[model samples]
Target: MKEGNAISDAHQVTAWPPIRNLVSDMLAISQRTHNGYGLLEFDVTTPLARIAEHKTRMPDGISFTAFLAYCLGHAIGEHPGVHACRQGGRLVVFDDVDISTLLEKTKPDGARVPVIYIVRAANRKSLAEINEEIRRAVRDDLYDDPAVRRRRRIVRMPALLRRGVWWWIRRDPVRRKRQWGTAVLSNVGSAIDARPSWGLVQSFLPCSVTVGGIFERVCWRNERAEPRKMMSVTVAVDHDIVDGVPGGRFVARFAELVEAAAGLDEEFGTSAGDRAEGQSR
Candidate 1:
């Protein structure tokens, strides 16, 4: 941040406000409670192919976040227990499948900052609708995003008091369910380290899913070597809320829904280009 520092050095020295607030808030959530978590990675090659086809056929590129939310939403819908939290005497299962996810946007200073967004009732929305929502979340600058507002508000609070407020938000089941949601997803598909594999993360939530980079790999099908596009998906479930058996089942269900997504042309009738053209006229 010095007047003449090199770009890399300056970036290292500068702690962007938005990203700092995000980390601070996440730390508060981590401190709220402890949950036994396990990581499971799935080879989601089949559905990835379907997603690729859908992308090619659609005029407006679809957001991977939208596709993921659709798949995860349906899977959670079938197993509502995954989104439930235990109270003193009862379990509270939210009917809506709200998904909290991380997104990166360029700050006014030209540095990229990570922001959190929650897609409420994802199970109730179609793929097209989810796609539009994510597009709007990123593209529309007419209104401040919820994450931006929260970051602005939190940054104004004293550090000592901010953590307390965040802890309070996470501690309340109703508020947490509404704001942070039952399941969490982080998209790391774009940041592929040439390390030969994906990263596994155990988020402080009932369930957390991370989608890693998609790369071409050799596959041996019917004794023939062929190249196939494959991606890594890590799903972590709270052991207290979901046991291994159900956890495995949930992952399998998510994979099934992703692979089973069909008829992109029929699902999305209008192309993004067409919509834009109509708007311009």
Candidate 2:
């Protein structure tokens, strides 16, 4: 492959000690388990309906990103292994919810590079912060900066060369521990317009699981009506973390929460009395 300045430049090297340690730990765990890989899938129609309804009015307020984060946190809280990585026969489960999302931005010339980051304490992050972090990572050129690119190259080097390079980079303990997170979130919805049929996504080794959203077509039947708005949502997940039962339950609960939140306006009364009360308070 003909390498460009973005790929071969030395300045591209930056310290990412945490990511290195995480990879090392994961490798160790995989080596210990008889079957290092696992998979799971479920249908979340109910939850999707609830989420869609809740977001109908406040489209910007209740977003897909926030919903995904909430669901992931809920699932991980119940099943800790969902956020665990294998390290040489031992499974290391993280205490906090650190989610890594992929970001791709167009450059002046139109080329794009995807970068990933650890969104600190994703469970507690507000809708705005989640959106802003994704925006900042994509717009700041942090992914393409010379230093970042160099570090990526070194990390991706052949196994033989990687040992020495990675060792030198890991001298900083803070960097090494900083990168480990409970799980990863991949949004492939940007590629397709419509939601896809519910299914599990296949991904690489190191990553224990992956989730994707697809186009959805939903119709509402009324007494005199035929069809309603064409709407959809995307879903992606790793199978190894949880079994069918728990996965289904998680999806069901998620749907319930979204649905309940959506009906808040109607339940609280959108009538004149409600309006007057609002004015009084």
Candidate 3:
């Protein structure tokens, strides 16, 4: 009731970190781009099963994010136009599918932050390689690099100077791809306790994907309702480069690959008995 009573609520002010500032800058820039958003669901039962099976051999285990990266790379390889960036009057499409993913790390002060790691030539790498790379990035301090350090310095600069750096990067497709990668794939699902249906992500990259947690649902199959694992995936593409048709085709192909569990067997060496058993099933 009194002013003094309202002050009883507890709060503390912490200075915003450089990483947070950088993310804010990226969002501010991405807002200017024409972005098309799509919220879609995929059946991930097959991939989960396969990942569990493969974990018997892989002690560290494979992650669902790695599987998604595998599927996304292949999808982009099939539809490269979806990740093209406009350069003057022409569009620049890179042959390699470099995917930038965020890895959360805790600082010495115990503050958690997300760091970007690019999986170079993701389209050409096997699922196991991708899984190992992600695991290695988490296990070691590789996520902290000179480039990120440079970014930390950039974020500390004045807002106008920081924005100038981003503008310079955005103007050239080659520099942008080399620095930030051709696409972004972030998985926020694994970190949270409760499953989220969907989440929107902003990025300066041409294509960005946000992978959400899985929820069980019933789907009509063989004239009967069957329980299935479903995940919400949000995709945003730069309309300046990616058109509606190509973007739709890319999304459809990505869904098909994910539903089919396209690359599970390629992750590791499977015994003949295991293959035969899988075939029988």
RMSD of each: 4.9, 10.3, 5.0
Task: Give the lDDT ranking, best first.
Answer: 3, 1, 2
Q: Write the per-residue lDDT of candidate 1 for residues 1-281, one digit (tens) a residue.
A: 55575555334465455457657667556554445444434445665565576667555567877888988988998888777776657778888899988777776779776667788898888777777778777765623766558656876788778777776766677877765788988878768852235556645567778877776678788899987666667776766678778877777898777656522445454644354456469
Residue 120's C-alpha lDDT in candidate 2?
65
How many steric clashes does model 2 contain? 32
Looking at model 1, the pairs that clash are none
Worst 10 residues of 1 by lDDT: 32-41
Query: Over 4 Å off in model 2, which ranges?
Result: 1-63, 88-90, 143-151, 163-177, 195-244, 254-281
Q: Deviation in angstroms for 3 in model 2? A: 38
The candidate, 1 or 3, that scores higher on lDDT is 3
For model 3, residues 119-178, the per-residue Cα lDDT tens digits are 889999877677767877776675357667767778899999999998998899888887
Candidate 1 stretches with Cα past 4 Å from truth are 1-18, 31-48, 193-196, 262-265, 269-281
lDDT of each: 0.70, 0.47, 0.83
User: What TM-score, over all chains together, does every model reach?
Assistant: 0.81, 0.53, 0.89
**Candidate 2 residue lDDT tens string, 153-240:** 7666666577666444443323433543445566554464554423243332223234433433344445454322221332333455
